[model samples]
Target: MTRKQLDTDIVIAGGGLAGATLALALTRAIPALRITVVEAFPLTPDASADTYQPSYDARSTALAWGSRLMFEELDLWGALARHATPIRHIHVSDRGRFGATRLAASDHDQDALGYVVDNRWLGLCLMSALVACPQVTWRAPAQVRGVTNNVRGVAVQVASGEHVTELQAQCVVIADGGRSGLREQLGFRVDSSSYGQHALIANVSTSCDHGFTAYERFTDAGPMALLPHGSGDRAGHDSALVWTLTDDALERILAVTDEERCQQLQQRFGWRLGRFTRIGQCHHYPLTLTTVNEVVRPGIALIGNAAHTLHPVAGQGFNLALRGIMALVEQLQQAQVRGEHLGSLQILRHYQENHRRDCQSTVRFSDSLIQIFGLDIPAMKLARDAGLVGLDLLPGAKRWFARSAMGLGGRRPRFGAVTQEVMDD
Candidate 1:
């Protein structure tokens, strides 16, 4: 029996946010190109559907200013606006210490520093935009069974239903996730290390209004953040909580009831939010740092978590990946202009080279922050506290931090043709 062969210019494995966003960007950038996205879980363009897939679930994401610009460029921001809550200010401090710093959007001359949007809403927006593109062929509920690289390009074996279809593409992008089987099949070496922490996440109602402010409080156990998530079903004001804890702590926390967990959270986070009245369902994710030493090969590339996974402390994971996607889109556009093969080693190499520095630097920055703050030495603690206080006092230092946190540092891709108000170097 012979399998049906489908051909496209590019085949993207994984139709999650990253894959969907890339498909939209590429279709807009190169309208003539043929693209196919294979996702294991089914996705619907209908925003009303409630099928409960992991990718389009209750998890929330923080979209940095730069990420917002990218979505704006793609014309997907308006769809997400109603569901998103702007983060006008950020309050960072060390629990039980005098170290603290505040970041205000007004001080940076920006309307908002970032936004918090539920993943379900974002998935709907991205899928809706993707459906509008006639150049894309979305294959949901399809799994990549195998991949073979040939002289011309790569051939992917996809299993959908009872049929195995062969997809031939000039380039194949692996955006499935950190544990992508395709990534390993493609022979990319991955360096994975555990952070000895687990993130306990949930949405909760606070006694006091969040006022569009996000808080990051570092504690002896780990870091905890409460990002404003607007009003939800059971609340007047709500915030999404990401509390990192030790494995033992996580076990203990998970063993208790929701009310008990809320009490524990209140004890750790303090009276800043007044009190945690209620908490919704809780989820846990083990913290780990995963990196692919080599991101590109002859006819393949990896994006999003498939490329790297960072600690959730800084909320830089998705934003950094967005920047990398933008850079890759730019390189792909340039390659097309030059009549270069999209899957050629040269084109893939160019994309990798452009993002390598930014990836390394961002990962290092987040890891360094975690290590420095987690130090037990009194001197190091004093130095870190002084650094935070210094940031609060020094306007120059604060501005630099805001710029970097907004994803505007280093070589930023032109999000749009029109001039955007951004910080000057």
Candidate 2:
């Protein structure tokens, strides 16, 4: 295929949070490059970013402070911050144990350790931004049937309605998600380990205010987190819950009445935020630790959940994906400046090399939290208590923990700003 035969410079699979954000980053970094985003779900027609109203049971994501900075670079923080709830403090404790640790934003010299925003709102902001960029083309209610590497680049087969269209691009980015069929279609080897646990997610209101503090509690059963949710007057009164449970426990919980479920939750979480007065719609997801043997090929790259999926105990999934996005953009910018092929293996390798350490450390951090806390041996339990107490008493260790939770554990990558010329266009 020749230049004239190529449909776009880049093709992004799955226009969810990761895919959509990558599209915006690429357009801002390379003003002249043409890109196409293929998504399986149809977007809400005529959705206005300014008018988005989240539902009472809206799902939420925890954005690390570092992730906030990346959005600011993309000129999206202003819009996102409007609905975001700042986490001024984090309270972590082992259920029915004496081990506990507290982290404050003041100690880190920041306004917030992180922010919790509804996932729907975040998607709205990203989609709105993508629409304003002339260099991007979106294909929704469509599926990428297959992708194969060609001499000139990669050939992408996208199906919409009854029609199937084949498009060629310099690179294909697979951000379809953790269970990405596209990644497997390309023959990427994946290693997966089941935790034999499932997460029960829901939104709940408390009799007492949360004071903008997020809570993480560990029990013999599994780990549970309650993140501050909503904004303004509703902020302190409500929280988004992620409760980990065994298969049998999950079934029992789901079978109970709302009031009974709240009572069980209060039993596990204690009275930190008082009684769980109300519970919203509940969702369940199995816990798994998954990673791919290779994230990049000659003309392809894997990102977001497609590349790695972690235990939700630490809430590091999306934040880690954001860092990977920026790293890839940095390498692509360099490749563009050098007039090299965007899909060149050399360029893609550099991207992976820079991000490998961060990925490995994050995976270890999340998995370790689960393994260490999951142990029922008395000796291990004593050790865990000591470790938590020690972490609180040691300033250096506490600082490191704070940084890691804020997604600043590794070297930060620089993202290109949108040029004035492109802005004018």
Candidate 3:
């Protein structure tokens, strides 16, 4: 109905974690930049809080030590702390097998290993932070129709009802979603492969306290994880269930009623968490591996799920996006000091230069983990169990693996107080 145009240092497409975070980071890194973010869907803003935060949602995220350090610097962890659950310990094992490994907070000499949080809480916190930053002019409830790249910078067109207008900036970042129509339109092709699995997520009740332990069990069909949610009135009501299964098996599970579903889960899961009274409303996600080659093209840079969407098997999809966002911010800051435009090829290339290796490694690692672990061969089972035992046999190796999983083992941001050498590969 109404057409409008604006200007800023950076134009971000999509308001998910990556876009929102990059906008806020750039605003803080470069004062008075006036970042504009175009979001396709309209969302309600909770303006009452001193800090922007939304109510916790049913979908949860696993926050690593590295992610926490970044959030702390952005001043988001404090708001999230109120409702977050610490992952005090992790137990990894094969179903009906003798091979198992346990990692604890005491071993790491930290307060906790990581955290399990509602996705909405983190998104709200990031949104709230963006609103508080005077340098950022938040724009959402708008859709992106076209984009252009030139020497001046990358220009993005936003559609509002019958009218379409453009916003030009030094750089344009695309983070819309996995099925990023905008990304495709930019002539960026993403390599995608199916995992042949679907994940069913829901809040569930168990028989006993989870004691802050997270479970990763490999079954003949797939891997299942029982993560902790905050406690509630019902017995074992504090756990969130993330079950991954083959496509056909998942379809059958979805076809059943809630009662039957709970009965089936109780049989396989046993009474580990206590008696499974019932499962919550179930949601299904078709798992796939997607990666957009060339994160930087023309005046556009792809981030988050738009760049790469991995199987949720390891729960590091968002973590990887956040890490990449941090890498981009650092590179941008370096470019400015060199008197180069933030949107210049040199600056954007610097980002692609530094991150291409790490991004590919992470994506490949996630896909391989799902495939390798999903195989149910008798010999493969022995090998996997042996691998778990081998790691445990060496305390040092086990700790290293734990740190890597927490996103803290490698070269960390200075705020994380980790040395650069560790992550420099």
Best by TM-score: 2
- lDDT tens readout by residue for model 3, 263-344: 8887666666777766877888888899877888667788889888887766688888888888788777666555567777
Model 2 residue runs over 4 Å out of place are 232-235, 417-425
Q: Report the error of model 1 at residue 278, Å.
A: 0.7
Q: Judged by TM-score relative to the true structure, which candidate is superior, 1 or 3?
A: 1
Q: List the residue pairs that clash in candidate 3.
A: 52-128, 205-236, 206-236, 207-273, 207-274, 411-423
**lDDT on C-alpha atoms for all candidate structures:** 0.84, 0.91, 0.76
- 325 in model 2: Cα distance from truth in Å? 0.7
List model 1 lDDT by residue over 189-217, tens digit each. 99999999999888888889898888999
Q: What TM-score does structure 1 among the candidates reach?
A: 0.92
Clashes of each: 0, 0, 6
TM-score of 3: 0.91
Expressed as tens digits, the lDDT of each residue in 17-105 for candidate 2 is 99999999998888888999999999886888888887879999999999999999899999999899999899889988898889999
Every model's TM-score: 0.92, 0.96, 0.91
What are the candidates' C-alpha RMSDs? 4.8, 3.2, 4.6
